[model samples]
Structures are given as structure tokens and as C-alpha cells.
Target: MTAPQRPRVPRRALDGVLLLDKPLGLSSNDALVRVKRLYLAKKAGHTGTLDPLATGLLPLCFGEATKFSQDLLEADKTYEATMRLGIRTTTGDAEGEPLDVRAVDCDEAAVRASLQRFIGEIVQIPPMYSALKRDGKPLYEYARAGQTVEREGRQVTIRALELIACALPDVTFRVTCSKGTYVRTLAEDIGEALGCGAHLVALRRTGVGALTLDHSVTLEALSEATQFERDSWLQPVDALLSTFPQVCLSDDDMRRFLHGQRLKLSSLTIAAEAVNAARVRVYSAQGRLLGVAKPGEGVLAPERLVVTTES
Candidate 1:
């Protein structure tokens, strides 16, 4: 006899962000799916990606929070990584196939000096095994097909780099950098500068914008928790825009702004410093986060608007 099917859980609309401590071996999307299914979330997205070889803070957004997820992409990031000297890889990480190996001739002094050369503004050629698109296809696809593509060098800023430990063949370091900075490329570049090639062996992102790993919860922890426990872990949607200047609009203005109308800057109480900002967070007088706006010609024009929850 055929067995009866169990009732399926209905996906619910959930709003807020989850600071997930994404475990290694799962791509950012893989981790997001697991967490979304756990919550039965109707919609969800990640602020940024963490490779399967990386493990650390990956903020997942659900419902309204997803609207502001793009903001974090431009936020500075901090990572702690370990690179093996005298070795180069196809993917620039431990997961890649080793291309070559040599002797580790450089000491900590040499490593430190090499790292200094990468500090501040520097250019990097995006790796072929990256997600960068060429002709509507990811570069990784081309790489898997054994095809090489010429990529433009991008300028990225390295805010700081601190060597944590130097254990001869293995070097551990912490780096704070601007958006679009690739730690793997930095490791490879430093390796080349030291007269020996290197590739990332271990990597953990500790910070993104204002969020830190300390505030993140692991998938294992979430699995054991009840629905209420999971709900409690969700950060307010506005948390994603903490770095942006905020303006609380009046009830009339809130309605107009929500309806896609622009507001006069003279009528809104805006900080002088924020007037020239590229984007500003807009909120309702009742403390509800409205959305984001772009300042122009003494007016605040709606950019990305949040859909208000139904009554």
C-alpha cells in the first residue's frame, strides 16, 4: 500500500536580516537555502558571497531586508587568511589544483616588506576562475573549458594588513580593505613579490561594514533552535543601512515618498554633512524604515522603496 504524504510547510513572509556564520564547504547560496528552508522564508537573499572554502559572517536578508542588501556590497570588509609560500594554484585558494611549488626562501621580514607593497591603492587582474562576466557568461565557465580570457586590471584599496604569524612555509595575516578587493589575489601578488608564488589556504571573513562575526550564528545552532529562537536572531531591516544617514519624514511626506514622489530637501531635517551623500536612508515618522533616496537639486528622490506590509 502507498503511504500518505506529510503536510508541507507553507512559506511565510519574514522580514529582517540574519547574521549567519556560514560554515566552510557551502557556497553562499547553499548556506542561504538551508537557512531559508529552516525559517520557511518566502523570500531571501545574501548581502555578499563567501566561497565554499571560506567560513565566516555572511548576512542573509529576508523579505524587506533584501531591498537594502545591495548597500553592504559597497561596505569595507575584513578577512583573516593564511597563505602557503612557494606554491601557486589555479584558483588561488586551497581548493584549486597546485600549479607549481618552490622553496620558501623568505623570512618574516621579507614577507612583511612584500605585504607593505600591497597597502593603499594597487591594481589587480581578476582571476579567470572568478564570477566576473564576459559576454554574458561567468569567467569561471571559460576557465573550466580550458579557455583563457584577458581581463582588465582593477584598482583596489588595501586599508591595512597585519601579519599575525609567520611559520616559515605558512603565513597568517589580517587585512581590512575596500570593496572589490580579493584576498586571494593579494596573497598571490605578495608571493610574487617575495620571489616565490603563494596561494590562500584558509580564509575567514570577520567583518563587513558594521557587522561582525561575533554577532553571527552558525547553521548548526540554527538547526537546534525553535522557530521563535530563529526569529529572534533576525536583525531589523534598517541594520543593513546603519552607515547611511537617516531622515525621518512626516506622515504626509511618507505617503508621497512611498507613492514615488520626491521631497524638497528644505522641508526635511537633514544633516549638512549628509546633503551631498550619494544615498540616504528614509524612514517614517512612526520609526518605520521607508527606503533609500538620492539627493539632488535640493530634493530627495526615491531610489529603492520598501513595500509596506499589508494590514
Candidate 2:
């Protein structure tokens, strides 16, 4: 006979965002699982994927916060990366075997000039060993099978690419770029520009949207904290929508919004300029975040609203 099974603990309906300092070698999903289990959260998601080779700030969304998580995914990202010159890897990073090696001959001034060339808009051909999918399968799967597929060059803006340090074969730099910018491919391009092929050796994400590494907690710390203490680390749901304009409504109007009704733009007390925005965060008079709304010519139509027990 099978032994009696233990009772399962009910997951909590938690809401908020957690800035995780993801450790090297841990995939973002694995880290999210740990945070979810630690908080006993019923719903959870991450703003973006941090590769196993990277280590740094990874924002996690719980419950209501998940509603606005997509906003962060489209925001700018910042990272400090180190690339080893004179060596090119198949995957464009240290994780891959060296495909080519040469002597490093570029100076710091030359590195600075090369960085300037990528300061604005640039095009990149994503590597084979990436999460991009084709025919319902990730390109990485095709790469593992030693197959190459055609990938078009995508236009990605490199808002800023500043050199941090240069020590012969290894070069460190900080980059701020728009969403979908592949830094590994960037390092390879820069290396080729310098006449010395390179591969990424280290990467640490420091910022996403308005969130930064300054207010992040490591997994090790969360493991040692009490459940209540861990809950305190979560930012309010509105944190994910910081860049969006906010519209506060009365209890009665909030009820109407909950029922998928629209309000006249003239009825709102916000500044004239804000009413014209594409999206706005809707909040109840009692300071509760209701959800989001899109402004029409004269009406504020509900876009994505919070899920409530009553509705």
C-alpha cells in the first residue's frame, strides 16, 4: 500500500514586484520558481529573461503586478559586460568552445572609437544559440543539432555604449539599449570592428525601465528571511507602470470601470496634457490601483483592469 500523502499548502494571492539579484548560472525561470515558492505566491512572472551566463537585477511580478509586467519587457535595459578579445566562440560567449583565436592589438583609443560607431541605431544578426523560435522550436534547439537557419538582421538602438575598462585581452563596458538588443552579437561586432574577434565573458544587468540594481535582494538573502520579511521586499503593483500616466477615480466611478464602462475625459481632474496619453493607470479614490485605461477622443475606455472578487 502507498504511504498517506501529506496535505498541500494553499498558495497565497500575493501582489507586488520583487527585484531579484539573479546569481550566475541560474536561469531566470529557476529563480522565479524559488521566489514564488518562498512567498507561496499563486501567480508569478518575470519582466525579462536573464540568461544562465548573466548575473544581476531581475524583476519578478506576483499576482496583480503581472498585469503590467509586459511594460517592463518593452523598456530599455542596462548592463555591464566583459568581452575577451582575440577569441571568437560559436555561441559568441565564454560558454561556447573557441572557434577562432588571434592576438589582441587594439588600443583603448581604438576601442573608444569602435564604441562610438554603435552609439545610436545599429543592426544585428542574432546568433543561432538564442531563444528566438522558428517553426515552433527555439533556435537553440536547432543549434544543438548542428543545424543553421536563416535569421534576418534586426534593427536595435544602442542608446549608449561606453567603455569602462580595457586590460589587454579583456575589455569591460556598460551598454544601455532598447529591448531585444543582443549584447553577445554586439560584442562580436565590436571585436570584428577592432580587427580582433571576441566573445562575452561576463555580463551583469544593472537596470530595466526605472528599476535598478540599487534595490535588489539576492536569492541567498531571501532563503534566510522569514515569509513576512520576504513580502516586505516586494514593490507595489504600480511600480511596474511608473512611466504611465495615472488617473484617479471615485469609488462609484471605479465600480463603473470594474464593469468595463468608460468615463468622459473632461470628468477627470488630471492636467490637460496627461489626458491625451495613450495609456493611464486607473486608481480608486482610496488609493487602490484599479487597472489601466486608454483615452479616446472624449472617453477613457478600460484597457486592462485588475481582477477582483466582485468582478
Candidate 3:
């Protein structure tokens, strides 16, 4: 006997930003896939990558929101991290085998002083277990093969680093840093400063730019929410570009802008300083978001244009 097959549900055209509270033990992409399936969205992307060992706020973009996700990637980030002093790991986190261990004899004042030394621009050699590439392959591939490669030290800023608690072997801290800052490496450096090697045991991203963990929903919660409730969690596509200056255009200008034509600065309802800014959000006269633009010598050039339903 032949049985009829059920039809697959069609993916919907969804657009917005989701502040997902990524759970531990799942890679950022894994979490994204689960979220995508839950929403049945046609297009999706994440602003940054978080290791499986980390749990925190991860910004997700759907449809038009993906176009501006790069903005969030370049923004500063904040994290709450717990490092195990007196121990070093091959991967810099607890996921790897222990490489070394020493006595933890440092006090609160010493730990605070050690954190102060990292509160500014510093150079770091990217760990071999990172996603950074060398010759088109991830460094972790080389790491798994027991290979070592020469790496260059790059400059990164640590805007703020504060020790929250000093519990001998376990030290907890909060950090606010510029893009590309590696907290695991910071933990290792702090350990070295205290005469005891360390490795990150726990990490939680608290904030990215204007997004915070307070408003994020876990995958479990999303899975149980109604369709309308899931959709309610989505922020407008323009939410990612909230920090950028905005300019609303007339009907004629909106057409020209969408056509990839440059508009004169005088045509935009933006301040002189805003016109001088590198990037500005574009909007239609009807208050609908158009896209993003770059300020040129005397005009605003289209960079990324949003395709609205009406368009």
C-alpha cells in the first residue's frame, strides 16, 4: 500500500533583527539554523561568531537585515568571563587539554593591577585554534593536525577590563573592548602577568553595540512561543543602523536612490555634519527605510539598498 506524503511548508520572506540568547554547547551557526527553522525564514545571517563553549547574546539578521549586519560586527562588545588561573589549555579555553598548571597565589589587588595593564591598545598573536585563516584554511585545521604556524601580532583596544571577583583558582571579570579583541587571550595574558598560566573556563557576551542580553530570547523559549510571539521578538531591519545618521528623501529622490543614482547633499534633509559622516541610513518620505548610503564629495551614493515589498 502506498501512503501519501505530506507537503513541506514553504519558507516565508521574513525581515528583522533577532537578539538571540545563544545557549552553551551550540556553535553560533548551529543556533542560527535552529532559529531559522523556527521562523521558516527565507534568508538569515549572524553578526558575529561565538564558540560552542560560550553562551551569550548573539544578533541574528533575516532578509533585509542581513545587509546591515556588518555594522554590528564592527561595534564594541562586552563580556563576563571566568578564567581558571594556574592552568593553561591548548585551545586557550576549557575545551582543550591542559597544557600547564601552576600555583595560584595572587590576591585581589594584584589581579586588579594585572587587569589594568591590559586596559588600552595592545598587540595579540591570534591563537592557532581560532577561525582566522592562513592559506585559505582555518587555523584550527592546522591546530588539529598538531602543526604550528607563524602568526603576526595585531593591535586591538581593550576599552575596559575590571576584575569582579578573585576566588583563588577561579577569577571572574568583565570586559568591554573593540572589535577583534579576544578574551581568552586576555585571560592567558593576565595569567602570565600573575605568574600563573590560565585558560578561559566560562564566557558570556553581555552586550554588542546597542544590543543587550536582557532582551534576548533563548532558543528553547523561541521554540515554544507562538508564531505571532516569535515575530514580535523581531526588531525592524533598520534597528541595526540606529547609530547611523538618517536622511529622508522625496518621492523622486527615492526612485533615483533606488536606481543606484547619487543624490546631491543639498537634496537630503540631513545636517552638514551628517553629510560629512561616512555612512547614513536612507529613508523614503513615507517613513519607510530605503537602505544605506555613503557621503561623497558633494553627494550621497547608494551603498546597500533595501528591497521593500512595495518596491
Candidate 4:
């Protein structure tokens, strides 16, 4: 006779964020689910989506940490990308079918010169094989059916783009850019500029805002650790808001703040040069992070308040 199935373990309520070093070939959500199951977290979400072909730092938010994940989503990102010159793909990456191939005759100097043209603010059309929606359907769905859609070019800033290495057909580089920047499109654009088409062969995200890959933990490492050891990898929820300026509230103000009430500027321990109508990280007198608030006129209004239990 077959043994009866064991009872499922109860999921524990978990808070804090995990800097996951996502592995290649797994979608961001798939990776999040695996990590969530490992932690037995009651609530969890990823800050941003990474393509299955890409790998590296993926910030996973849990419980109250999900409240401020938008901060990281809006933050700038850095990546190390490898592009194969002379070959273009339908999806702009290696996963797609090859579309075209041309001779690659450009040297490093010519390639470097071409990359300079894309350094500043430039308009880029979103790729068809993207998650962008059109009339309630993803662009990729239409693309899969061999349909083409008109896409408006969006202006994105490329703060830094450096060519790290160039070996005939393969060109590797690093890029630091604002949110919404598409590196695959960038490779294609650069290839077009060099008189040869190109497609992304490999991509790895190295940094997201203030978070870097160095502090991230891999799935294998988490899987090998004990439950308590895995929990140790989580950073406090407030770690997401480290970039925002802080404002401490008095005991009375803290009480009001927690109740979702507005507080006067006089009640806050703020800097004299604090900007008006600026978002500030709110904290109690004990230095515990309360949440995020916005300054308006002479009052501090709650934008997102952390649950006390999670705090």
C-alpha cells in the first residue's frame, strides 16, 4: 500500500526584502515563488520583472516591504550586456529566431564611436516582443500571431554606456540608465549605427538603484541553508527607502501619523532646507521607520503608512 501524503507546512507571516541573485532561464515571478516557498512567506512580491534570458539582482519584497517596492521600480538600473554583431533576431535576444545576418567589419574604435551616439537622451521604440499592452493584450501576443503594431518612441536617458570588450562578432558593455530603458533595443540601435545588425546574446543586471549584486543571495545558497539562516538574508523593510530624506516625528505626531492623520511641520524634526512638497521617509522618535510622507504647505501627509505589526 502507498504511504499517505504528509501534511503541508503552514506558511509563516514574513516581512522584509530579499536581494535575490536570480538565475538564468527562470522568469522573475517563477524565481519569486521559489524564494517565497523557501521562506514560507505569507506575502511576497518582486519589485521589477526580469526576462528569463537575463540574470542577476532581483529585489523581492515581502509583507510591508511591498508597500515601497515602487521606489526601486522607479530607480535607475545598471547592466552588463553582451551583443552579437551581424545577427538580428525576431525578439531582439538569442531566444528568438534569427532574422538577418551581415558581415561585421567594424573595429573597436568604430564600435566605440557608434556607442557614443546613444549615450545621452534618445528616443527608442518599444520592442514587439515586450510586455507592453495594447488594447488589453500584450504586444507579444500580437507579435506571436505575426501582427505588427505602431509603437511610439519613448525618451530614456542613458547616463553611462561603456564598451568593456569587443571581440569580432561579440561586443560586451555596461550601461546605467533610467527606468523603462530597453537594452535589447539599445543593442539593435547600436548595430544599425555600425552598418551591421545585432541582437542581445546575454544580459545581466548588476545593480538596481542603491542595491547591487554583491549583497544578493542565490537560490542554491538559500536552499542549502536552514530556515533561520534563510531568514537572515532578508533585509529590514525600510531598506527600500534608504534614498529618501528622513523626518522624525514627536510622540504625539507619531501617534497622529500612525492614525493616517496629517501633522504640522512644527511637529517634525526636519532639516531647515527641506524642500516643499517633497516626499520624505517618516520615522518615530525612537528612529523606527513609520512610513513615507509628503510635505505640503505646512503639513506632512501620509502617502504610504507601514502596518505597526509589520514594523
- Give the TM-score of each candidate: 0.94, 0.97, 0.96, 0.95
Q: Which residue segments of model 4 deviate by more than 4 Å?
A: 1-6
lDDT of 1 by residue, 1-311 (tens): 98999998999999899999999899999999999999999999998899899999999999988888878998999999999999999999887899999888999999998888889999999998899999999999999999999999999999999999999799999999999988999999999999889999999999999999877899999999999999999999888988888888899999999989989999988897678888888988888888899998999999988886621
- Measured on C-alpha atoms, candidate 1 has an lDDT of 0.92
178-239 per-residue lDDT for model 2 (tens digits): 99999999999999999989999999999999999888999999999998889889999888
Candidate 2 stretches with Cα past 4 Å from truth are 309-311
For model 1, give the RMSD to the true fold. 1.8
Instruction: Using lDDT as the measure, name the better of candidate 3 and candidate 4.
Output: 3
Q: What is the lDDT of candidate 3?
A: 0.93
TM-score order of candidates, top first: 2, 3, 4, 1
Stretches of model 3 off by over 4 angstroms after superposition: 1-4
Model 2, TM vs. native: 0.97
Each model's total of backbone clashes:
0, 0, 0, 0
- Please write out the lDDT profile of model 3 over residues 237-308, one tens digit for every residue: 988988888888999999999999999987667887678888998899899999999998988999999998
Q: List the residue pairs that clash in candidate 1.
A: none
Model 4, 77-118: lDDT tens digits are: 999999999999999999999998899989999999999989
